[model samples]
Target chain A: MAGELALVADILSIISLIIGIFFLSLGMIGLLRLPDVYNRLHATTKVGTLGAFGVLLSIILQEGATPMGIKALTVALFILLTSPISGHMIARAAYRMGVKCCEGTCMDEYAGKRRK
Target chain B: MKRRLITYMALPVVWCLVSGYVTIGSLFLGLIFGMIVVEPFSKLYRLDEVVHPTGDWLAKIPKKIKYFYVLIKEIIKANIVVAKIVLSPTINIKPGIIAVPIRAKTNIGITGIANTITLTPGTLTVDISDDQSILYVHSIDATNPQGIRDSIRDDLEKYVLEAFE
Candidate 1:
């Protein structure tokens, strides 16, 4: 029974890691190909957190709720907590730095408030 | 009073997680340390008191769990959408910022909604007004900003209300 569980865990871990790496690779591609800092930030923040969560989840599944598994969960929690805040801060800073939104961008709500 | 004491319950729980120890000795030590640690900043945890409230916290626990379930679903959906866009042959994203007026009253609720919006794919919360009435959101595609606003109001803000309010 233990061996079977381990086999299931191994399979899950392998699949999760593959999918995680796949998402991370796309985030990297988005970083390179996106036209501006804001777009790249979107790609990296949203995609990267999920990718990291996937890897951490696989670790938890492999370890079966041990202390390390709990710790991994905590790390994942922190990732979710901090990633978006950091992304928001950077995006705000980019806008403050006068980073241009993409040419195709149709609106700017913060534009009027920029001068004041 | 009663609510603050209830808020104290989280301290040892966090201690157990961060210390990564479940033994009786560690738990006793964690209790001692948690008391010392949580005492100084009890006021900061006022948000917890407000969110948890005095009555029916145990019963309402399921709602918070449900919110997280929805959040995780949205997060995964977001990543899949972003992955598709990133891997597309030609990038055709039309990006812009739009103002979204929110109804979340508490600080925690507002922060929760903002973070949820920012974490979701294709949408990022760029700014909140001084009065905290509006969240300026940057979207990777803004052809229909009203749709984005409505989706956030319905999908994210309602859950935040469920969990925190």
Candidate 2:
């Protein structure tokens, strides 16, 4: 029974790791193919963070409920808090620098509301 | 006074978590050092004005934990949507920055909402008005701008109101 459980854990770990790697690669593809800085930021931040979290989950599955697993969970928590902030900051900076959105961008709500 | 005492006591607890040692000697040393660390910041900690008083803040922890759980669910949903958008062969997206009028009263409440919006689905809090009445958000998809604002007001802001206001 113990051996069977260990085998289950290993299978789950591999599946999760593959899922993570898949998302990370998709993020990279978006990064290269996207039109402008803002879209790139979206792709990298949102998809990339999820990908990283997937990898962390795989670590937990592999390690079970031990201290290292707990630490993996903590690291995931910190990533959730910080990744969006980084994305927000970068997008804001790009806007402030007067970077233009791509042609496909359907709306620009802050179009006329700039003081600077 | 009470605020000062609470921070002084709390710092050592935070220190223990960070240092990852629970020995009695380490805790006692943390207490002494925590006092020294927090003393200079005593005047700066307007805990009564800027935040809930210490006891009230402590009382809100369970509600905060519940909020964290809700936030995680939103994040996972968001990531899946983003993954689909990014991975699709066609370069599909509609991006805009809209002004999201906010209702949170205090600085802590406003910041809490802002951080929550930035972290969760399709939205990012870019700037706030001088009077703090509105938050300017750049969302990856705001084709239905009102939907974005309503979701933030209802889902995110309500719990923030519960915790901070």
Candidate 3:
């Protein structure tokens, strides 16, 4: 039974790793092709963060509930919390610096607004 | 008193979990360090102000769990949508910023909503209004700004209000 469980875990780990790498590569392509900082952030913050999270999850699954698994999970949780904040900071800075949105942009509700 | 005690206990467990050393001696050492850190700095750690002291904590746990479930599902859906957008040939996207008026009153609630919006499908929270009443959101698909605003107001904020607020 334990042997079968280990085989299942190994198969799951490979699948997770493939998914993680696929997203990570997509994020890289997005960062290169996206028109502006805000759009790039959409690529990195969501796609990149989830990719890293998937890789970490695979590690945990492969290692079971050991200390390494616990640490991987902790890092995954921290990545989820911190990645968006970094994206928010970059987007806010770019906006305040008067960086223009791309050509496809349809509207700007906070166009003339400045933080008080 | 209760807050201090909770902090004191939590800090050591955090220390052990972070350091990956779950032995007794390390825990005792962590306890000593927790006291040293939390004692003189008790005034700075005003968690009650940050997190409202809501009653019936037990009742909120189920709601919080459901919120997490929904969040994870949305994130997976978002990844697939973004992948499709990125993989498509022409890159037809209507991106822009829209001001979303928010109902979450507390800092935690507002932050939670913003982060949740950022993580989910094509929307990203850019900034908050000076009065804290609105969140400026950037959407990859801005052709229907009201759709984004209504979805945020209806779907996301409902779970946020229940869990965090």
Best by DockQ: 3
Interface RMSD of each: 1.4, 2.5, 0.9
Per-residue alpha-carbon lDDT of candidate 3 for residues B116-161, written as tens digits (9 for 90 to 100): 9999999998999999999999999999889998999898999999
lDDT for model 1 comes to: 0.85
In angstroms, give how far residue A17 of model 3 lies from its true place. 1.1
Which prediction has more favorable TM-score, 1 or 2?
Answer: 1
Candidate closer to the true structure by DockQ (higher is better), 1 or 2: 1
Q: After superposition, how far is residue A105 of candidate 3 from its true place, in Å?
A: 1.2
Off by over 4 Å in 2: A1-8, A64-67, A111-116, B1-6, B13-55
DockQ of each: 0.74, 0.49, 0.79
Q: Candidate 3 falls in which docking quality class?
A: medium
Q: Which has the better TM-score: candidate 2, or candidate 3?
A: 3
> Which stretch of 10 consecutive residues in model 1 chain B shows the poorest summed lDDT?
B45-54
Q: Write the per-residue lDDT of candidate 3 for residues A34-81, one digit (tens) a residue.
A: 888998899889998879978987998899777788788778878889
Q: Residue-wise lDDT of candidate 2 within B1-165, one digit each (tens)?
A: 556666767877655544545567767888899877766766677534343355687888888988888877876777777677776778677887788999997888887888788767777777777788888887888689999999999998988888777
Indicate the docking level reached by candidate 1: medium
